[model samples]
Target: MYYVTKDLFFPPVSQANRDGILAIGGDLSTERLLLAYKSGIFPWFDPGDPILWWSPNPRMVLFLDELIVSKSMRSILNRNVFTVTFNQNFRDVISNCQNVKRNGQTGTWITNDMIEAYCNLNESGIAKSVEVWQNDELVGGLYGIDLGTIFCGESMFSLVSNASKVAFITLVEQLKKENYKLLDCQVYNPHLESLGCREIKRIEFLRILKSE
Candidate 1:
């Protein structure tokens, strides 16, 4: 376990523990966050805990071509039940992600500091948010770092059924149209699995991240 310092550097991802925790205690400065994402690491820790950086061995990712849009989701997409936009209402999207309750989690990892940091990233065009609106009301959305060809998703929230799914699927479709290479999901979960995200070896993921 490495402890971060004022110097902006991280140990190689190869040194990450079995659980993928690479380092501890680092500020979420835009510079550091950008560097971390480029290096295939991301911050994920409880509110009170020092910032924990992870590079899981089997990195979960979604190749745009492999995205699974279920028949119901396709029907929803065709219905145009919700309007989606990018980089619109980013602060609200992240805040909702912070407050939305999740199963097995007592609190949120998206702390106020995290929100402020990523919001700054958004202002600089390095971070992005996808908003889902219903009748002019923000119902669901997601935010993440955009590395040109790779998008490192951080978190998402939904107030109504399928709202987040709509945001996600729309984002995937847009990325595919834009010729994005990969969507780095960080870790595996059933929710993402249903959307066709799968785990790949960390080395393979790094290769994709570094590829043109």
Candidate 2:
């Protein structure tokens, strides 16, 4: 396994292990994070562990044209009961994602250092968040690195049923409007699969990521 240093460099995605861990022990500087996303790698590590960068094979991605909104979700959207906002309360959105309990995990990969680093990334306009509000209260949200052409989703949390889906669908509609090519989910997720996210080879993903 490769080890990261002060220099903002990484092994090629092809060098990643079968489990997708590409490098270890890197700081989450804005420059490094940007480079990692552009290169099909992302940071994900548990607390008290060295920062682990991964570039998984068979990347999970959603083409803007392929988003699948279930009938129930469509009804919820039609009702317009929840308000959605962009870049509003990013810290809260990410913090909630970090704190929310998920199945099969004792802790979150979105550590305090990761949060601070990505918050800085947010201030730089490279990281983005989608907030869902119900009756003026923040209920659910998602956050990620927006590379202009493709969105690399990091994490999402929902306090109420379908609130995260609402935030996700809303973000997809906006990205579709802007003519985005893809939404990179990074790894396999049944929830994302239900929303039409499917896996493609890492090479294909990298080609798309670098495409003009």
- TM-scores, one per candidate: 0.98, 0.98
lDDT score for residue 188 of model 1? 92
TM-score of candidate 2 versus the correct structure, residues matched by position: 0.98
Per-residue CA lDDT of model 1 for 1-212, tens digit only, reads: 99999989999999999999999987999999999999999999988888999999999999999999889989988999999999989999999999999889888888999999999999999999999999999999999999999999999999999999999999998999999999999999999999999999999999999999
Per-candidate Cα lDDT values, in order, are 0.95, 0.94
Q: Against the true structure, what is every candidate's RMSD?
A: 0.7, 0.7
lDDT, candidate 2, 1-212, per-residue tens = 99899998998889999999999997989999999999999998889988899999989999988999989999999999799999989999999999999989888888899899999999999999999999899999999999999999999999999999999999999999999999999999899999999999999999999999
lDDT of 2 at 197: 94
Best by lDDT: 1
C-alpha positional error of residue 171 in candidate 1 after TM-score superposition, expressed in Å: 0.5
Q: How many residue pairs clash in each candidate?
A: 0, 0
As for candidate 2, its clashing pairs are: none
